[model samples]
Target: MAGRGLHHVTLISSDAERSCRFYACFLGMRLVKRTVSHEDPGTFHLCFGDEAGRPGTLFTLFPWQRVPRGRRGACEAWQTSFRIPSGSLDWWSRRLSEADVPHRLDQTAFGENCLTFEDPDGAMLALVEANPFTQPAVWNSSEVPAAHALQGLHDLVLKVREADPLSELFREVLGFTEIGRNGKLVRLATHDGAGGTITLDETGRLARGQLGAGSIHHVAIRARDAADQDALVQALHDRYGIVTTEPKDRIYYRSVNFRSTCGLLLEIATDGPGVDVDESFEALGMGLKLPSSLEERRGELELLLPSLPIPTCNRHVFEEIT
Candidate 1:
């Protein structure tokens, strides 16, 4: 079935608090959740996004204290794109410059102009004009100075050794059609355009990507609910022999993940039990809104976590708490 759009994109991090500070201050996102990793404790999982903490806007961090740094040449994620106002390219450039942020300026085959940069932890990311090709975003009630904040994740590029199996899944299974194909890259996309496009690349049998500050954990696609997710999971198994787990509640939403043949990771997530379900959108990240069990440990958690609000340039000093 033609389904819901892009959900959140998850990634791994070496330092959760430090990464959180970078994203929150620099990107103007709200810290929606901070908890121990479901798979491992001592390790932490954090999420950042607009006040509402909607799907497309959600970005998660998995702080694996032992992961090593990775190189950027190939075999890893190419870049993550963000949406900005139509004429905000100049403003963004100035903001990045003022922040002393290191980035690159170039034009994509789609003809959109872009500026790439690395986060404090070396995660590759970029800012692109949400111009003549994109629609205006609905601002979040809890997002500060809302209008200028990012609408959501624009798109992401995955540089794999091969694109055949992965590209086939995007179209034949997920319903994303190949909208643009060019040298080394094939782009599959959804309508919202916020989760913009998924670009699959054939950059040779590149080295396997390392999970560090800048590496993606998995890209999550939106699934309606338990019933819907079950059906979709079955579809993947039936059609492609790709198996997925039963939906597991992630506190905020339910999800299941599977690795693609090309080595990319993908997850299907439900939209409900939204950010507001746990905390009001307008009041998110304002306090240490922790689970009752974690409440008693807040003092220790806070102390263990690094300081929030890392430095950044003019526009917004986005910070992230990994």
Candidate 2:
């Protein structure tokens, strides 16, 4: 089955408040939802994205408060990239400087210009020039103007020791076509620049990365519906001998996760019942939201979890990026 595009990317953070400031205040993503993780309800699961929290726009995090810092190396998603409008790099550079967030501007071997920076917890991220075919929804409440705001994710970068076996999975199982390659970086595109693209970087000498604070949790691929997700899951098991989790309801969407040959976690997620499924668009990310199962203990959870500043109308709390 052919995959649609990227659904979302989930990463680990040590400080939810700091992360929220970096993303919502500096980077200008909407704090779409705030809820507890299904697996570990004690910790928070925060969602950030474009205006409406579209599939490819989603950048989520699990705040593992006391976890140790992770090292970046092979067998990990090293960077998550967002698409920005053409010619907006200079504006972004100035903005980053104003916020005192250091970043470097560089061009890929494939000719895409990107600005790379780290979040509060050192999760690597970038903003690349958007492909003409990919138009991400503009965030109206963004600190930056709509024209200069970050678009949806352009692609993701995975570092591994070998690319052949992973290439097979991208081509055969994930419905991504090998578009181009430059030395150690191989580009795989789902719809030829329509959105979801992955670059596999072969780094034979580096050690494998550990999962902890500031590390990526999993890279989720987009599926149109349940049938499409099921087909891909079946293909993974039958063809690659990969064992994946049965579809688990994530409230926003249903997801199934598995690890790659190199040990990078991969998830296949449906595109709907989005972040606004429970909360309305107008009141998104306003307060702590709990699923029905956790509603009974909402009072207890509220007392335990630290309160985060609301980015919508309360921008003063995050006035300084330092």
Top of the candidates by lDDT: 2
Backbone clashes in candidate 1 total 17
Cα-based TM-score, every candidate:
0.85, 0.93
For residues 1-322, could you state the per-residue lDDT of candidate 1 as single tens digits?
A: 7656578887776665556656776666767766655554445667777556777778888777546765554444667888766666677677688777777787776777778887766777877776533443444433234555677778788887788777787777677888888887888886655674677778885677556656777788887787777877888898888878767777778989886666567888988878676667666655544555566777787776545443233332333333
The models' CA-based lDDT, in order, is 0.69, 0.83
Q: Where's the lowest-lDDT run of ten residues in candidate 1?
A: 310-319
Query: Model 2 misses residue 163 by how many Å?
Result: 0.6
Residue 170: error of model 1 in Å?
A: 1.1
Candidate 1 to truth, TM: 0.85
Write one digit per residue (lDDT tens) for candidate 2, span 57-111: 8889998876788988788898888888899999999987876777999987689
Identify the leading candidate in terms of TM-score: 2
